[model samples]
Target: MNGLKAGLAELEALIAAPVLGGCNLLVCPPATLAAAFAARAAGTHVQVGGQDCHWQPSGAHTGDIAAEMFADLGASHIIVGHSERRTDHGETDAIVKAKAEAVARAGLTPILCIGETLAEREAGEALVLIERQLAGSVPEGLAALVIAYEPVWAIGTGLTPTVAQVAEVHAAIRAVVGPGVKILYGGSVKPSNAAELLAVPHVDGALVGGASLKAADFLGIAAGAA
Candidate 1:
């Protein structure tokens, strides 16, 4: 929702960054740019992905993009149940589960996003809600997956949780998802606080937003992960 075709230049900048080993930089552009992004990122550490994906492979679901379509375009991953989608589209855990399964079927990794709103957090229901969403949304036997925890209130609000709070939630998430699953933090992530957030326990990566529009800032955050 935030990019124009000019966004390709950002991807190009990332592609030109030094190939630091073990650092995976994935960009999920709007469906409209999937082909071009994927094609450009081919053979590079910069991988292309999808912001959202439909559960079904092909259907009459107008304006919906499918996981298979993304896979066909060389997208290695797809985000399911992002907070915005949950709020704006009313996507449920069941719908996210179906989409995860669809992503696995297409040989792509599913990045399942689970988070709580400000009210839910203040009510002390954040962990409970996240656990419930994980149980309901994750399909059995996923070969590869990623979890993104984005506090709904913090997204684009320039406000973030304390490092301790992030650690607590991520630790709990780690216990449920086990050691293999990579958990990411996604709430106004930028270079300024990237190192602190990435250093938090159980945080394997970032589900970056606004800052990613600029390659220098995005790369700086990636550098923090190194």
Candidate 2:
């Protein structure tokens, strides 16, 4: 919540500066902060998004936020199948696919995340793992979805896969997702490595972690995406 507020304030300042024109920004904050951020971002170039959403549009699921609620709050996008959600909540591919469908039904774009762990990569199973995740996690007619590849072992670990490795995984993911899907790289994406990572084949953008908390780093990564 605090970070969202801080980012909104920073965005206002950046917009006021005439030199910072021609940039697009999207902020995905916690559910509690979505409405507030959406209202604050109204009429601004900055767009608001939800960090996660429930698989069902409306249900008795305890402590789960639905995608419709996020859309009602004016969220334009929703992050699904994040590494944290998969690791901490034990979410599977089927669950993520349902969530993606819910997001689409709610009229929001779903950012579908897919990746492999260190063990899988070490065993030469990264492509295999990603293929399964892509096939099982994404629904048919995926034009409204965005795919983010976040290697589980790299997130918050201060470690990242090599440029060649990233390119290979992204290429494999793109092949499976077809030509329309935008494949983004995530996991410890820092300003220092953003340039190289963004240059990789099939890498459309990044789902940054700790580095995204700062305006400078996030903007640097965004700029690299261009």
Candidate 3:
């Protein structure tokens, strides 16, 4: 939902000036800019992605973009079941699972997102809620995928959970999903706390949002991953 044509050049220059750390860098820009950004980031370690995709390969779905469409645009990954999608579009877990399967079928890694709201956390049902989402949204026997835990309340609010709290939830996700799946912590991730958050156990990386819109801030967060 962000980033303009001009912005892409600035970001590409920054990334090209110096290599990023070992962590994989991916950006899911608006669908309109997918191919352009993909071309812009080509020949670099950076990868381009899609914000979301339709479960179907192609149909008369009107405005909906298919998973294969994103794949054709040189996107290496696509995000599914983002909290905002669930909240705004009323997408159910079943829908997310179908979309993830589609993304995988399209030969792109699906970044499955799962998290709880503030009310659910306060009610002491955070773990229970996330566990249910994991079981429902994640497909069986899918060995390759990325999971991002973005608490609904924390996203874009400059709010973040404590390291222990983040570790606790991530550990829970790892417990249910088994090993091999990288779990990234989202929600207001910035340079200031990126290192500390990335250090948390089971916290494989970050699913940055707002901070990633800027080159310096995004690079700073990526530095923390190093």
Candidate 4:
């Protein structure tokens, strides 16, 4: 939602970067740029995905984008249950679960996002809240499942959890979701902090935000992951 098509060139440079081993670089732009991004990323290590999608395959959903449409547009993944979607659209865990299933139905992967709000965190219920969201939002049988834990308080605020705090929640997520699933931390993940966050145990990767808009910053973070 923050970018215009002309700005695509900034991210297009990512396509030319050497494929870093052990790092799976991906860029999930707003729906409008998905196909164009996918076209540029074809045969490269970078994979393009959708920011969000609707649960229904097709119908009168008005402004809502469908999961199947993402796949048709060459998107390999679609992010479901983002905090913004939850807050702005009043999407519930059940709705997120349905959307995950919808992404799977479209033969695309689902990056199911779950997190706790500032109130929930200050109430000392962050873990509990996330666990509930995880239980309710994630569907079964999602192989190579990707779950992004983006604390609502930290997103785009330039505020991040301490390494120990991140470790604690990520470990908790691993305990419940098991070891096979990949869990990513998503709050304020800038190049400066990406290395530390990626180094955290149970922190499989990052669901980068603002920094991703810049090629240098995003690649620097990818270098850390690599």
Clashing pairs in 1: none
* Candidate 2 local Cα displacement, residue 124, angstroms: 0.8
Clashing pairs in 4: none
Q: Assess every candidate by TM-score.
A: 0.98, 0.92, 0.97, 0.97
Off by over 4 Å in 4: none
10 residues in a row with least lDDT, candidate 2 = 14-23
Error of 3 at 209 (Å): 0.5
Tens-digit lDDT string for candidate 4 (103-141): 999998899999988899899999999889988998987
Model 3: per-residue Cα lDDT over 21-69, one tens digit each: 5788888888888899888788788889999999999999999999999
Global lDDT scores for all candidate models: 0.92, 0.84, 0.91, 0.89
Better of 1 and 2 by lDDT: 1
RMSD to the hidden true structure, all candidates: 0.9, 2.1, 1.0, 1.0
Residue 54 CA error for candidate 4 (Å)?
Answer: 0.6
